[model samples]
Target: MTKMNHKILLGAAITLASLQQASAVPFAPSDARSMGMGGTGVSSAEVASTVQFNPALLATTREDDHFGLKIPQFSLSVADDGGFIDEAEDFDEESELDTTGQGRTNVDLLSDLLDEATGPLGLEKMQQGIEELKAAQLLPNSAPIAKKTAYDNAATKLTQASEFLDTRLYSRNPSVNGEAGLVVYSGAIADDMDDLNNKALRINGGLNVAGAVPSKKFSMAVHAGAQVTFSGKVKIDPKDTDILRNYSAATSAYLLNIDALQLALTNLDENDSSTFDAVDTAQQAVDNFNYGGAGRPESEGNTAIFVDGELSPEAEDADLDSEIQMIGVAVADVGVTASRVFNIKGHDIAFGITPKLQKISIFDYTQELDSEEEFDSEDFSENQEDYSAFNIDLGAAYQFGAEKQWQAGLVIKNLIGDDYESAEYISSNGVGGAVVSISPMMRAGISHRTSWTKVAFDLDITENDPVAFEDPTQYAAIGGELNVWRIVQLRAGYRANLAGSDQDIMTAGIGISPGPVHLDIGVMANTSDIENEAGIALEFGVEF
Candidate 1:
C-alpha cells in the first residue's frame, strides 16, 4: 500500500465515475439538424421542437400541426489543473518507499510485503516469488510454518502503509492551497479535482406553444418547456477536523525534499509524536473560536444570561438559509415578421425578416463572511434581471429550373448589435464586457424528395465571441447535418474556443409522425471525451 498504489487506485476510480456520467447535446443548430432536418414547414402550426433556435423558422411549419415538444438529454465536463500536485506527491512518495525497501537487509521479506499490497508490483512480484519458492520446495504444503510467517509479516506492513497513504492522498486539503482569489477549494479534493476538470450531462424536455402565433407570413409563438441539467458540486468546509494542514504541508515539503520538518517529526519515538498532536489541537482551537457569532447567545427581551450567570450583551445567530431565493417564468419568446414572394425572370423567390425580443431573469444567493461577527449574512435580494434585447433574422429561398427540383436558402440570425445589459447590481461594465450576445449565423441546406425517401444536407456556421466572465475569446459553433427518409438524421461537426481549444460532436435522431402528432428523439456524442446526450421532442399539429 505505497502512495503510488493509492494514487493509481484513486485515479482509476475518478476516471470510471466520470465515464459513467458522460452525456451530450447539440450546443448549436447544425447539431439539431444532424438528428433530422425536418423543420422546413410552411406554418408555425407544425414547428414544435425547441423553438428558440430560430423563431422565424416556425413559419416553415405546416399549417395543420399546432403544438410541439423537445426533450434533450444534456451533460457536460469541466476540468482544472490546480489539484494534480497532490496526486503527483502520492506518486513521488510511493517511489521513495520502493527505493527504501530495496535497501533493506531482508529482500525476501520486502518482496513478500510487496506481494500482499494491492499495487502493480505487489501482484506481479508476489506471484513470481511464490512460484520460485514453491519450485525450490523451500516450504512444502505440509510444512507451511515458514511460508505463513513470511506472508503475514509482509502483509501487515504493506496494509499499514497502504492505509496511511490512501488517507493522505485522497483526503481533502484541510488548508487552502494557492492564492485566495475567485475560485474556492473544498470537498473531497481528489474527486473534486476530477469533477472540476470535466463535466457532461443530458437534459430532456419539449415546447408547447398554441394560440401564440397566427400564420406563416407573420406570427408569434410563446413556448413553455423544462430542462434538467446534470452536474456535480464539491461542498467543502475549511473547518473539518479530519484535514491535517501540516500533513498537507509535510506532503508538500516531501515533494520538495525539504527535510527540516520531517527530520524533526521522525526523531521522536512513536509515543512522543506530541508535535503532531499539538498541531491538531491548535488547529481545533482556532476553528472553534468563531468570530462570526455563530455559537453566541442571543438576547431574550434585551437581557443576556451568560454561561456563568454573568450578564452580557446577547448576539443573534446569522441566518444561513434565507440568503437564497428562486423566482422566474419558465419560458417566453416574442416576435413579429413579414414575408412575400416575387417573380424574378419568372422564377419564384421568397424572402422574410423577423424581429425578436428575448428576456431573462436569474436569481442568485451568496454569503460573504463577516469577520467582525465571525458569521455570514442571511439577507437575500434580487440579483439579476436582464432587460429585453431586439434581434432580427433574415431568410430567402429561390426556386430553380422548370420543375423547381433544386432549392436553396440562406438564414442570417441575430443581425443586430444590441449589447443586452445585465441588471445594475450584477453589471460587468468593463470594456467589451456586455451580457448580450450578437451571433451572426449562416445556414444553407438542400433537399431532394422521391416517392420513397427524402434526403437533405445542411451546413451551419456562427462566428465566435468571448463572454465577459469567461475566457476573453470563445467561438460559436460550425457543423453539418445529414438527413434521410425524412425520418432519420445524422450530424457531425467541430467546435473550437476562440482560444483554440477544440472538440468534435456527432449525433443521430429519428422522427415519427402519426396524423397530427409527431415525436422526435436525438442522441449526440463528443469525440474529445466519452460525453453523450439524448433528447425526445413531441409535437401536435394539423396540416392545412
Candidate 2:
C-alpha cells in the first residue's frame, strides 16, 4: 500500500477531548484525597468528600466537622503498558526523515529500483535481445558462431546485472542493519504490523462539585459530576500482512529470474548439431523462470514478478484493511446522599443512601489506519449515543475500639445494574454493536484514626468491567495521612490490582488547609514501568 504518515495523536486527541464527562463508568475513586490515599476513601473520607467515598462518612467523621463544600475536584489517568504511544511516535519520527545511514528508506530504494528494472532500457529489452538470438535461423551445416557471440554478449550483460542486484539489494551492509529505523525487506512491514496488533491505550478523567452538611443525628450531601473514558486499540487484518509481505518477496523473485536465465545461456552448447535445441533449452528456462522454491519456498505458491513482467501498481495502491478502533464514554451524574447514626447495642452505627440520576453518552469511532478521512466535533457527536437513568448507592460504617478509633465501612454503588448500548459503528467483522454495563460495585474498608494520624485500607469485593475494551479492575489499597497540627497533611499509599490485569500504583499527595479553606494535590505512577501508567488529581474546598 502507499506509504502514509501515521500521527497517532489524531486518535489520541479524540478520546482526550471528551474529558468533560469521562467518569463514574470506571467506578474508581477520583478525588485528590482518595487518590492520594491509594483510592482508599471508603472509610477514611472526611465529611467534605462523603458523597464520593462513603456517604456514611457524613455521620461517622470527626465530631468537630459541621459543614463542607468541594467545588471542581479533577483527576486524570492514562495507561499504555503496551508501548503503543512510543511505537507511534517512533514511526512518525522515522517517516519524517530521508537518507539514513542505509542510503535511502527501504521502500524508496525498492520503488526506484522497480522503475528502473521495468524502464525502456531495462530487463525487458535485454530479454527481447535474447529472444531474437534464439529466433535466428541457422544455415545448413554452418557453425553458429555469430549466434554464440550474441548469446555471450547477453550472458556477460546478465552477469553484470546479477552482480549489481546482489550488491545493492541482497547484500546486508553493516551500517544498513545497524540503523534504528525500519528496513522494509520481505517481512519487515509484516513484523511491524504484528508488533502493533492488540496494543491498547486507555485514558480516564473526571470533574466534580459537591457540598455536605454533617451531624451525628442526621447528615445530607449533594454532588454533581462528570467523567469521560476513552480506549483505543490496533486491529490488524491478516490479509494486509500477506499482501505486503508477498510484494516484497516478489521483488526479490524478479531479480532471481535474471540470474536463472543468465546461467542457462552460459552453459549452452552452440557448435553441436543440436545447437537450435540448446538455444531452445535456454529460451525455455527464461520463459518459464517463475522464481520460486527458495527463500519463500515452492509450496507457498507463485512469487513471480508482477503484471506483464513489471512491478504492479496494485500492490502499492491497495487499501490496507487494518484500522484503529476507538471508543469513548462520557457520563454525568447528579446525586443526593442522606445519612444518619443510630445507637445499637450500646454502640453507634452510621448508615447512608444516595439516589442519583445519570446521563451517559457513548462514542464509537472506527477508521482504517491509512484512511485520509477527517473527524470533527460533528462527526464525533454523530457516532455517539446518549441515555438517562437512575441509580442508587448504599453505605454503612461502624466504629469500635477503646476510643472508637477503629472504623469499618461498606459501600455498594449502582445498586441497580444496567447496560447501555453504544452507537453503531462498523466493526471489523462487518457487524455494528457494543454494550457498556454498569454493575453493582461492592467495596469494604477499615481505618484506624488518632487525632493527627490516620491509616486506612480498602478492597473492592467485586470486579468492575471495562466500559469499553479494556481490562476489568478490582483494586485493594492501603494508605495513610499525617495531619501536622491541622495545617498541612501528607499522604501516601499503594494500590494493587486484585484482578492482576493492570499495574499497581504508588500514590502521594499534600493537602494544605489554611483556616477552613483546603487545597489538595495527589499524584500517582505505576510501581514498575513508570512510563506506562500515571495520574494526577487536584481539589479545593472548605470544611468546618
- Give all candidates' CA lDDT scores: 0.34, 0.71
On lDDT, the leading prediction is 2
Every model's TM-score:
0.45, 0.79
lDDT of 1 by residue, 289-348 (tens): 222123443211112212221111221121111111111111123555554455678766
What's each prediction's clash count?
56, 7
Candidate 2: residue 144 Cα off by (Å): 13
Those runs of model 1 whose alpha carbons end farther than 4 Å from true positions after fitting are 1-34, 37-247, 250-331, 362-381, 423-434, 466-502, 527-536
Model 2 Cα lDDT, one tens digit per residue, 255-366 = 5666666666767666574655655665555555443223546533343225544444434454566766667878889999999998888878999999999998988766
